[model samples]
Target: MRATSIILPALVTALFLPATSPALAQMAPPPVTDDVNLSLQVEDWVKAETARVILVVDLAGQAGGVNRADLLKTAAAIADRTDWRVIAMDKVSDSAGLDRWRAMLETRLPEGRLAGLAERAKRASKPGQQVRIAAVRFEPTLQEMEAARSALRVKLYARIKDEIALLQQTFPDRRYRVQSLRFNENSGGYRDAAPPPPPPFIPPPEIQMIGDPIRTEVIEEVAPANESGSGQEDKMIVQAMVSLGAFAGPTQ
Candidate 1:
C-alpha cells in the first residue's frame, strides 16, 4: 500500500506536468496589436467620373478582442487615399469611438451621400458588429449622377460618348470636357433612370413681361372757304380751322 501510494502520486505529477506538443510548440501567438486583415476593391463609375472603393475588414476573428485605437487608426489610414472617401460599416467595435470617428470624418471630408449612408448603417447594425468601411472615390455631382443614370446599360465605350453629348447640350456655353471614362463591374451598371429633371424654370410672377403702351395718331381736316368775298367768310374759315384743330388735338 505504501509503494502504491508513492507510485500514484508520481503518476499524478507526471500527468499534470506540461507536455510540449507539436501544435503548441509550432503555433504562433496572435499579434499584440489588434491587426485585422484589410482588403480593398476599387470600382469606378465611368460615366459619373467617380470611383467606389470598398474596404472590407475581417472582424470575424476579433470578437471581444480588438483594440479600439488600432482599429480607428487602421480606418484612418485606409481613408488616407486621395481618390477615396471612406464609409465605415459593419464596425463591430466600440460604438462611441466609431460614432466619434464618423463625426470626425464628416467634418473632414464633408462630401458625397455619406450622411444618409451612415445613418442607414447605424440603423441597420445591432449592438456590436465590426464596422464595415466603404470608401467612395471620385463621387459624381448632381449633374453627373443624372447623366450616369440616363446612360445606364449603354456599353462603357458608348456611355462616354453619350455623356459627352449630354454635357455639351446641358452646358452649351461652358468649355467642359471629359478626359476619360472608366467602368467597374462591381458598381453593377449605372442607375436605370436619371433623377427627375430639376423642377422646370418657372419665371417669378414679378419677372413676367409688361406690355408696351398703345400708340395713337391724330389727323386734321379743313373745310373749303365760302365763295362770298366778305370778312364774315374769313372769320368762318378761321372758325372752321379752329374747330378742326380742336378735334384733331393729341389724344389723351
Candidate 2:
C-alpha cells in the first residue's frame, strides 16, 4: 500500500506568534541547538513501514525573514530533478492552530507514525529562537530506499544547506551558523541509521544415508615404530560407499 504522507505547514519564528514574550519564553527550548542547526531526520511515518525525511533548520534570536518561500522553491526544484517528495513545513501559533495541526497529522500520519513528533515540536518551540522544519518523503516503494539514500537524500540536504548559507549571507546581523548534522529519526538527534538486519539464515541440508548397506573397502600396512625399534604399528584405511537418495536442496 502507498503510505500516506502528512505535510506539516511551515512555521514562522516565535516573532510571528501572538503569544507574549514571557509566554513564549515559558515554552520549552528548541529540540535542536539554538545555533543555525540544519539536519535531516528520516522517519518511518507508518509504524515500521514507509519512511520520510524531516529537514529541520533551527536559528537563534528573532529572525527577520528566513525566506521560507525561496527555500521551498529550491526544494521543489530539487524534487523535480531527484524525484523526491519535498515540502515546506508550517508552524502553529495558538491552541486553535495546534488543534488543527494535530487533527491533520493524526488523519494523515496515523497509527503512531508521526503524531509523537508533532507533540514534541509543540513543546520544543520557544520565543528565544526561530525554528524552521520541512519534510521530504522520497518514493516509498520498497525498491527506492537505496536510491533515496544514495542520490536524492544528498541533493535534499545540499539544497537546504545552500539556502541556509544564503540566508546567513543576506542577514549577517542575524549571525546564522548553519550546522551540518547527521540526523537520527528515532532519537531525533545527530547520528546515522542503525546497523542493517543480519542476513537471512539458511539451515544446512538434512542428509540421510539409505540403500547403501553394501559398501566398504580397507587396506592395512606395517611400519617401524621408532629408532629404538620397540615395536611395529599397523595402519588401516577405510572408505564408505557413494550413493544417491531422494534430493531435497537446490542442486545448482
Candidate 3:
C-alpha cells in the first residue's frame, strides 16, 4: 500500500491532465504498483587515450597531374621506406574534381613528427605531376574510444553512489536500495523523436521528467578536441533507480 501510494497521485494527475497534455504527452506517466524509490542520473566527460592523425595528399600537380599508378607506388614506397609508420588510410577520392585523385594517409604521428612527414611529401612532388601533403585531421582510435567509455562509466557510478549516500543520510528512517541502473551510449540531450526524448537534465529531489518509476540517464555533449588533438572527450551518463522502505528499526 505504501508503494502504491507513491505512484497513485501521479497517475491521477496524468488522467486529469488537460488537452495541453499533448505537450506533456512526451512525458510518460510513472508506473503504478512499483517499488517506491528515488531515481538519479549523472553524466561526465572521458578523455580519449589515443589518437590517429590523417594526412591528405593531393596528386594533382601544377603542370600536368601525378599518375594514379605512380602515386599508388609512391604511397607503397612511403609506407615501406619511411621510418615514420606512414601508411595508406582509405579509398582514394576526387582531388580537385577532375581525373586527379586524392590519397589519405595515416600515422601514429608522435609529437614533432609532422614536419618530417611534410618534408618527405614535398620531396616526392614534381613540376608536371606533383604529390604533396594538403591537410591533416585528428581521429580517435578504437582503443581510445573504449578507454573513454570506461572512464565515463566509472565517473557516473561514483556520482550515483554519492547521491545514494546523501539520500540515506537525509532520510535516516528509510532504508534505500538500488533497484535498477541504465547507461546511455549516445550523449543525452533533448531530441525530436516519437514519444519525445527527455530534456537535458539531472536527477534531483524534484525531477521534472514527470515519470514516477524509472529515471533516464542524463548525457551531455563533450567538448571537441582542438587542432593538436592532445585531448579528446567522449561523454556518458548513468541513471540509477533507488527504492526505499520503512526502517522499522528494532521492534519495540
Which residue pairs show collisions in model 2? 9-89, 9-90, 10-89, 10-90, 10-91, 11-90, 11-91
Candidate 2 lDDT over 1-252, as tens digits, reads 233232222244455665556656457432432344344433322111332434333323222434554444433332222222323223323433321110001011222233334334434445542222233232234443344344444554565556566766766544444344443322112224545774644422211111113432111111112111222111111111111122122322
Report the Cα lDDT for residue 195, model 3.
Answer: 58
Counted clashes in each candidate structure: 16, 7, 2
TM-scores for the candidates: 0.19, 0.18, 0.43
Global CA lDDT of candidate 2, please?
Answer: 0.32
Name the best candidate (by TM-score).
Answer: 3
**lDDT of residue 166 for candidate 3:** 75
**Lowest lDDT block of 10, candidate 3:** 205-214
Q: List runs of model 1 lying over 4 Å from the truth.
A: 1-46, 65-69, 75-143, 146-252
> What is the C-alpha lDDT profile of model 1 across 1-252, one tens digit per residue?
889988998877656655465443345332222111212222234333333434333343443454545545544553444443223323233323432122112112323333343333334344433333333333444675445444542433354445456555765653334433333323332455546764444434322221213322111111122111121100000000000001122223
- Candidate 3 vs. true structure, TM-score: 0.43
lDDT of each: 0.34, 0.32, 0.48
Clash count, candidate 1: 16
